[model samples]
Target: MRSKIYNAPCERESVRLLRFAAATAALSALAVLAPATASALPAEKKPSPSVVDVHDSELTDKQIRDFWTPERVKEALRNPAKAPATRAARSRTATSPSPSPDLAASAPARGFAADAARSGANTAAGLSVSQEVPAGAGNNIVGKLIYVSPTGELTHCSAASIVSANKNTIWTAGHCVHEGDGSGEAGWSKYVMYYPGYSRGADPVGEWTAARLHAPTAWTQDGDAYEADIAAVVLNPRLDGNLEDVVGYAFGYLFTENRTDYAGAAVMGYPAEGYQRSDLDGERLMYCAGDTTDAFPLNPFDDRIKLDCDMGRGVSGGAFVWGPQNDPRIVGAASHVALDDAGQRVSDDLFSSEHGSYAAALINTVNNEG
Candidate 1:
């Protein structure tokens, strides 16, 4: 396997490791959401996803921990940079066109900010109140992800743990792991790491590094295909056991055959905006709860399941859950923030590609491999 180096960032003042007492105190004030429900269309009988083994970060566990120090994490959280790596460069060739200005526009507006406020759901776009996950219910299901883009910039996104045979697979958006546009260093991300139960600056469940990645060919080939914008990653087990075992839980996925509507659903992510977030800095998991609707012709590139939640940029790979709260199934991931007619992202109008046979096959292949 080809390996990529995590280009180190400029050094800064060192921050101390997390304290258990502080974490416990913070957890006391966090509020968890109820069970998830959603409407969905049945999955089409398509062939398995054309899986592509993408880039490998190749960093050791200690290196990952050391690289993402509290200082760096604080910087990322306080002022999270938008998608800088994916901005297609301005090409000079006659046939090659310059990267569209819209591609580099700010993240879409938070999904359902207005409707949510009117309905008494939190205005920042999730659940009925503060977006923090309950103390223990979301320990393993959601976490903060850090990675180096192809051009070598440090950035973060949200990701989730999934039930896999190897017991070490994670699910996230395709753009989170690879340069979906197929440009950049080796066309893949480097030094990718996931920190479950990462609150404030503490990693309660330890860090999981990416050993291998699997993405749909459609994304790797061009990056514009939203329907095929999901990815699965196999992680190196830490301390002699897998991540799910360490955190005590993992989530399942769903692939219905016909389109369906949900009465209610929960969308969980690590967002840096839409709340009193100076403390958490994208460290604690937050959620938006509401019904889902179809927004088929909005983007033209993919048929998205429109939700009235206010999730924004940093939560790109967070899970959209349907079913019982304690044991919900993931039907899709927070893909791209849907863009409005003026080319700005619509935050309250969150969108996710319908997970189907292709996603199932991709996850199965990654877990079964080796």
Candidate 2:
């Protein structure tokens, strides 16, 4: 569970994003109570996992290969000018002063091959899991693992993967972004950033400045972080020139809305949680296999994609795609699921069309937005 609005300063603004939004709700709005929707999924007789629709007759089901990946998702960014309005949510991090940007420099080819190779190898050799993280990420109130404030405080700041052109880019679960004092606000901590492949205090791996941030507008304007539960971020100048190139952007889904055959799907992220994003138990590489249901009220609880992938507070805004690096076609993101019910926490798989846009429309946004 994550503390909503650890960052209190932006509480007022974040309230605007909430559902029954009021003037100054504390973490109550953004803070997630365990099982946001009290619908205990209740343990039922064991059943075989359902298969998702992988091949579409309308569109050729391209053989997802080893080259597909979350890093390469940025290829869609080619349409920088046409990206979606979703990018606007990032305004908080981008407009802030002092967090400062490096005078734009032509991207260098330094360490591209060496770094990408290392990242690939590391991922291939990383832990493996039998379960998957839930489908969403955000500020939960119960069982919180960490806490971060709008003032750059980091008792529990959510982590994101940086993938900016300057290499100053990162992705985090959405809760870390909108929970200004737990009101699901848009403003984030000023000095906030991420520690990639973060291990204990060592902060030994890569570090980048939070020059820009982007999450779905739902999270920023409507406090509906649960809906778009994904985010993109830009790094500081350090990414301009680095040893390891850092990871690339996550690819968009092959479809605009939801697709299926995702039972064996894979996802990866530096979930600041003690458990690995993959583990069926806590703390292991998480794997996913479940069904998505319709969206409901209370806790937005409905038939979204369901999964038993164990996740903690930090895994929000992470990517849930087809085989991750191997088959980078993004299928869904981590939405919340209720565990006490026994179905385990089921994750919803949101697609480009779920928001009623075509694949290219989303591509257009990624390419055009500033």
Candidate 3:
């Protein structure tokens, strides 16, 4: 199978698109663990699945925090063309089995009302396909994640703080944290930092650096499998407290959910391109809400869901949320854009791996080991 996979990341001028054949590999079975709850789980007692792979940034928190100066961040925003490109190996063709019914779980968000007070209204031009997240809507949980790629390019992707036992874990796409397991390309990102409530370079909630990054072996070891494109980051605490405490909210999780559960769901991020809108420069929060459809039914090995969204690069790793606007649960992270046979992006479609047992296992590993 041939496909053009563009994992979104924003930098200086052009979007990084990877093209490769598809490889057939079965999804690995994850060790069962109890579902997470709103309360923190016991760190020493919980057992996580072995399928999760952890990558330590290996830099001092200060080193990571001090690298992103105002000027450097401005450069990252201005260039828009220097983003690192990963030449992933052939895509994996694998069937991801459904998780046990008992694995379905969720946790509530915290600190939203307080953070909304600090958020400002969206100021970018609107597109017919997506609208700016309303001001003071408590969507501060979603933000931008900036990091230096192994190739030394400064880039950014959308991410969100999630309710976790440690209260410091955030969710994003696997490609946001590690280049795919392609020859001469597999590696972790560097100087990872997250800016919650980021708008046009404004850091309303301050910045948090990653203490550790986690992705499934299927993404880091096997070919860059779309079904395992989810990742998590454990953040170092700020001077005041954890990320969710400072941002005033973290999105809840909805694991083991299917495409049917995402009707009227919202996919949000900072998109630098899409809908042919010149005003979209990855500076503000945008969202497209609608029903979703199976992206690959004939393959059976790929269970990603696609939304009728026009969000493009920089939206990768953003949250796909369900439920009421006031209280949303994250079902998946933005993974990639489907491309036509001509090798151009299918602008109307955004894809995400359905969150299931692998996601739960990854989160549990981060909570216990990170």
Candidate 4:
């Protein structure tokens, strides 16, 4: 798994890879171990008025595409934890220095994207069996996300396409776009590279690049804020056309708090464990379908959904879908892994931040600007 802190001066250790048993997997892995509820936000409130908007990368579309070659992507998958992009969690009271007047004065207004209509009826109630996406697949909107961190190390995660007026908005865990390091030390990710329907080291519809990032202040300020872990990325269209025109599918999502208990969903990602267990080198997409439960005590809040899926590392930013994996709407995006009683990172029972005002605002920001 990626280290919880990014760019820290620490040696990395090898984490064992774990995969879900196709027939034996069940929803019994849900466990809420931690109980620090002090920072939990009320679920009914709107997103915070202030958000962190970042578009500071210097790499252009061509530069990013050229930098992240197939060889680099393979190397990153081989050593998944070598250089995690996660930011270390600091005390909640830690504060960041203010931006210069030029930056603060020119910041855009806080925005919101109307929750798109939910698509496809909720169906099935079982664990999501791990499946590999095929090459040349049509209507596939979910795929691998690759990028270079500020330290210049190649990093990656999973992301899903979302329906938007711009038709270029994508969603994933906040840490996927920005290092989750506590305030001041963190910033937007650089050299953003995305490959939708990437299977077996192949870019099915070619790669896309990120133009901007919209994330909740909670995550930007506190790396441990799992409830606020989701982020929305606006992409620069490909040379051929817009993202939707190429993939031909983008999902809608729900922002209300009512979708938590729904069991008809699938959490999909390009799990590194799958690569370790086989010869694919983490290039295949895997998912675990099941109902979402409260990750409360362990997560210390209601903002995250707990599932029994056993995905690892590279899957951090994968989507939690409400219907079919290909053309489904989303309710959450996977963020962090839970720790066992022994304080060891556990692969099963992953948590995802639920879609809310923070997500809506991210979508809006991208639509208005991207």
Instruction: Name model 2 segments beyond 4 Å from true.
Output: 1-147, 151-167, 180-186, 200-204, 239-244, 247-255, 269-303, 324-327, 339-366
Question: Which parts of model 3 are misplaced by more than 4 Å?
Answer: 1-3, 8-49, 78-105, 111-128, 182-186, 257-261
Greater TM-score among 3 and 4 belongs to 3
**Local distance difference test, each candidate:** 0.53, 0.28, 0.62, 0.54
| Best candidate, lDDT | 3
Which stretches in model 4 have alpha-carbon errors above 4 Å?
A: 1-49, 81-125, 133-139, 183-186, 274-280, 297-300, 324-327, 341-343
What are the clash counts of all predictions, listed in order?
34, 88, 11, 8
Return the number of clashes found in candidate 2: 88
Each candidate's TM vs. the true structure?
0.69, 0.45, 0.78, 0.71
Tens digit of per-residue lDDT, candidate 3, span 1-370: 2333465411001111221110000000001111223454433323245466787778889998789888777765553222223322224352223234234456654442212211111222122276677554255577888887766778888898888877788999887788755322347888898888788778777888998898876666553444567799999987899876666566767666343234556678888887455677889888876655566555444456666678777888888766432345677787766556675764677777656656777776766664
Q: Which window of 10 residues has the lowest lDDT sum in candidate 2?
A: 9-18
Q: List RMSD in Å for every model shown.
A: 12.7, 19.6, 10.1, 11.2
Off by over 4 Å in 1: 1-50, 78-130, 256-260, 275-281, 297-302, 340-343
**Candidate 3 accuracy as TM-score:** 0.78
Best by TM-score: 3
The residue-by-residue lDDT of candidate 1 on 1-370, one tens digit each, is: 1101111000001111211111111122122323233222223232333444445656776776678777776655554324423321112321222121111100111111111111222223224232666666445557877877676677887777776667687888777777666553476777778887777777776788888877765556554333445688788888758876665555666643222234456667777654223443466677766655554544333344545555565777777665433334566677655444554443455666545444555565564464
